[model samples]
Target: MKFNATLLAQFFHFILLLIFLRIVAYKPVANMLKSRQEFITNNVAAAEEDRKQAEALRQQYLADMQKAREEAQAIIQQATKAGEVQAQEIIEAAKTEANRVKDNALQEIAREKEKAVAELRDQVASLSVLVAGKIINQTITPEIQHGLVQDFIKEAGDLPC
Candidate 1:
């Protein structure tokens, strides 16, 4: 074969093949590649949106848990305060009852003291009348008996009961 002629023919043939492939397959293959790129971009954007929504939901759940914990603490504090108030009320009631009982006991003691004093006066009066009758051997007038009893009480006034 002649070298120059063969090289020239091969070059012409390579140029024609490039032109035919550009017309037949280049545009379709480039369009397919662009469509695939768009599909990948759309999928990435959707995944990013989903991630953001998941983060928002997680934040909302954390906020709800914090609010619930605060409410529970408030309820516990209220219960503790109520219990303290109840205990204070019970203590006050017990103190009031104790005071009432003490007053009643004091009044009973005073009444008993008065009854004993009255009975002792009666006995002293009877003894004074009997002694007067024995000393004079006569019945004493009521006025004289009264005077003797009064004098005896006066003399005994300085003595302890």
Candidate 2:
């Protein structure tokens, strides 16, 4: 092949154009691409960290809800137990009061019965004294004695004497 000056000059021009383009466009574009890649990597890492934090918060919230439920259940159980105890105490107090009232009523009935018996005895004694006075004032006959005894029985059986 012959040494062509025109071919050599074209090759030199092509080399100079490549050098200029590399300095002006290629390096800047490569650096921009590298910076963009770094930015994307940093953003992806930050997004992953945020996702992890959100997951942790969700777990904590679930745990807190469970704990709250447990506490509420415990409080309800405690209240139920207290109510049962109070109900039992009320029943016991009512029973005690009823028993006391029953005893008091029985005692009152006994006292009334005793008072009635004493009043009956007093009436009997007064009627016996009155009969004795009539017998002393009258002639003693079988029919008169029987009639007086019957009259005494009638007065004793009737009330408001």
Candidate 3:
């Protein structure tokens, strides 16, 4: 091996360059990479926490919807029951009114029938009295009047005097 000053100086210069690059560029680049890795890890963890919170909120919304639906169904059922009750009440009231009207009509018919019968009886009595007076004036004898009266009575059947 031949010792050359120029070769040694070149070698030494290359070592100094490597040391300077390590101190100035390599360390700074390595620190920057480490910091970037930490930032990425923290961001990933925060994103995972936010995803969990969103999932919880979604579940809560679904539960609230279910409760609202149940309440609406209950209200509908109550309204249906109330409507049925009202309908039944209306039907009962109508039936009662109809029965009352029918009873009133029957009573009115009975009163009319009785009034007609009384009027017919009054006319019959008047006609019978007029006939009796005529017979009394024409016969003028007690025996004939008595016999005619008996015959009239027999022919008239059960009519009142």
Candidate 4:
């Protein structure tokens, strides 16, 4: 084998060039690409975590909203029941008042009836006495007077007077 100086020199130059490229460009580029990949992976992981947190928050909010709705419905139902009870009590009170008024009216009517009956009896007695006095005054003869007196006594005895 013949060793050539030109080929040896050329070979040395190529090796130096490769070393320079590796030092100046390849290594830095590879490192940059690796860093970029790591950054992208970290970002993806962070995004997934954020998404999971957001989903959890959404579920919690929905649960809270459902609980609030149920509580409101319960409160409304309780209020409705209480209102119904109050209404029933009011109706009962009204009925009681009506009964009392009816009883009072009946009592007043009975009192008035009693007063009317007593007045009628008094008037009848007064008229009967007046008629008897007129008949006795009209009798002037002794015999008629004696007979009239006897009749008046008998009639008066038969009455309440």
- Taking all chains together, each candidate's TM-score versus the true structure is 0.64, 0.79, 0.69, 0.69
User: Global lDDT for candidate 1?
Assistant: 0.86
Top-scoring candidate (lDDT) = 2
Instruction: Please identify which of the two predictions, 2 or 3, would achieve the higher TM-score against the true structure.
Output: 2
Structure candidate 3, residue pairs in collision: none
Worst 10 residues of 1 by lDDT: 152-161
Which of the numbered candidates is closest to the native, going by highest TM-score?
2
Rank candidates by lDDT, best first. 2, 4, 3, 1
Name the runs in model 4 displaced over 4 angstroms.
1-18, 131-161
Clashing pairs in 4: none
Q: CA shift at 96, candidate 4, in angstroms?
A: 1.2
lDDT of 2 by residue, 20-122 (tens): 9998999999999999999999999999999999999999999999999999999999999999999999999999999999999999999999998889889
Error of 1 at 132 (Å): 4.4
- lDDT for each residue of candidate 3 in 1-161, tens digit (9 for 90 to 100): 88899999999999999999999999999999999999999999999999999999999999999999999999999999999999999999999999999999999999998887897688668768876787868855888778777766665665543
Q: On residues 61-129, what C-alpha lDDT tens digit does candidate 1 reach at each position?
A: 999999999999999999999999999999999999999999999999999888878867876677677
Model 4 lDDT, full chain set: 0.88
Separate clash counts for every candidate: 0, 0, 0, 0
In candidate 4, position 70 carries an lDDT of 100
Off by over 4 Å in 2: 1-16, 136-140
Residue pairs with colliding backbones in model 1 are none
